[model samples]
Target: MTDRSFLDWPFFEAKHRAWADEVEAWAAAHAARLTDEHDADGSTRALAAAMGEAGLLRAACPADGKLDVRMLCLARDILARHSGLADFAFAMQGLGTGAITLFGCEPARDFLADVRAGRALAAFALSEPEAGSDVAALATTATRDGADWVLNGEKTWISNGGIAGGYVVFARSGEAPGAKGLTAFWVPGGLVRVVERIEVSAPHPLARLAFDDVRIPDSHRIGAAGDGFKVAMATLDVFRATVGAAALGFARRGLDLTVERATSRKLFGAPLFDQQMTQGAIADSAVEVDASALLVYRAAWLKDQGTPRVSREASMAKLHATEAAFRIADRCAQLHGGLGVVRDAAPEVLTREVRALRVYEGASEIQRIVIARAETAR
Candidate 1:
């Protein structure tokens, strides 16, 4: 169980605390039974269905059915603390349907209902081979073809790429050069087709999508024709904080496991926890974990309080939490000696998982840039 003390901070309200307890209970009960080793596609689908059955998907979006940053962060933190696969399952459910939740035409609303019901999986397809953090460098283009839009080019490093039922695709809309030319689309995955599913170090679902004149109705556009950048930015602003929350969860798990193991493992006629070195390590981890929690919830609370564009807060949270999670995981591995590197110990899995978080959702370096840009702009 998480330390309830974080709830006492000004960043969280009673409702957030209540939601945390509820999700924590659900996670404790169900996280262990769900394994993600083999049949990744099937496991992800099952995970989503289980999340839906638990009614956690309800919190993935807001009361108005829009994306709620606070709820997303809470769910990710809770689930990621319990299981990385669980967090991944929950995160994709929001990100995949985020565009529709924010801005979709008539048919998009019906599509969102499927997401809430777990009848379908959702994906966000914005990254490409040429574009990782540089959004302005994207080469994918979508043009109007009578009543439909014809899409061309490819999106790589896409989450839930092959498995999701639908995707919020971004492409150049011919408005102007750079970000302004981009537009977002709610394209059904079956309609777009996947080029290949790319395996990563962490073994989560990711793929490359090639749109070869993929025909989508004009009604599929999210926001205006040239507002893809705005839509994508707005969507990221909410979920980015949640990414940090997920990192916080990972760090918390690392701390818990390390503390438990240190107390139990004996060395040189005494428990590892008895050593000053071990105590220092644990203290450092605990402090960092709390710091991560503060940054994460601070961003969440700011958003809940109706602050616009938490780019700096989100960047700070994501950067700190992700970097700290890696450190915590590394320290856990070190504390375990050779056992930590073993697959059975889970640190090995966590090591890979934490590494991925540092890169995705904007890399640690990119986040630094974002924070600096925001600070300087102000």
Candidate 2:
């Protein structure tokens, strides 16, 4: 069990606590199916359907267009404690439809409805081969036609790339130089072709997408023209902290596994816990887990309290928690000896699951840059 005491922190409300309990209870009953090692796409699709049926995905994009960051964090933290695929399914629903929730026209809003219901998958296509961290250098082009925008470019590292029902694509519109010259579109999956499927340590429906002169009606545009950068950043801003929450969950689970092994596994004619080295490892893991929870929840609380933008806080949370979670997971594997290296073992699974959280959304190095820039600006 995770340290549920975090629920009592003043950062959460009675409602947030209730939501967490609800998700936790639901996960306790249904986690086996969602967590099993099925094919990546099959399992992800199954998770989407199951979570949607449970009404767990409704919070991802609410009808009122008001996102409760705390609720999002709580759900991700709890679900991630159970399984990373569960967290991925839930987070993508929010992230994939985030722009539509905030700035969708009627057609895009309809798509958001299906995503929230888990009838379809959603994806955010913002990165290109040459423009991973540099949003300004995006080369995808969106040219104006009479009633449509012709899109042409390649997007790599797109989550739900082939499986998603629709994508929120950012393309350069030449509104101005660099970051200013961009537009966002809600392109249906029918117009896309998968260029390549990306296989990562943790399997997911990741792929490279090629948009060859695909056309979306002007009505599918999100935010103002040339505001694509803002839309992408805003969407990322809301969910960045939740990335840390997921990391916290992974770390907490690792700590629990470590504790169980240390107290029961024998070494040198005594429990492994009797070893000074093992005791020190346990103590450090506990400290990192708690510190990560504080940072993760603090960022969520700041966003929920209506901080205009929480880039700095969110970046700090992502940077520290992800970095700490990886370290803690590695330690979990280390303490488990050779069993940790065995495929499908708890420690090995967890170690693989968490390796990507640091790189996706925003890389740790990018988080550092975001923090440093914010501080220097302050």
Report the C-alpha lDDT of model 2 over 1-378, residue by residue, as the tens digit: 567897898898899998998999987887656765657788788888888888888889787788998898888888888888888889999998888887776787777778878899999999999999899999999999999899999999999999999999999999999999999999999899999999888878899999998988999899999999999999999999999989998998899999999999999899999999999998999999888888888988988888989999999999999999999999999999999999989999999999999998899999999999999999
Q: Cα RMSD (Å) between model 1 and the true structure?
A: 1.3
Q: Supply the global lDDT for candidate 2.
A: 0.90
Cα misplacement distance, residue 7 of candidate 2 (Å): 0.6
TM-score of 2: 0.98
- Least well predicted 10-residue stretch by lDDT in candidate 1: 61-70
Backbone clashes in each candidate structure, one number apiece? Answer: 0, 0
Error of 2 at 373 (Å): 1.4
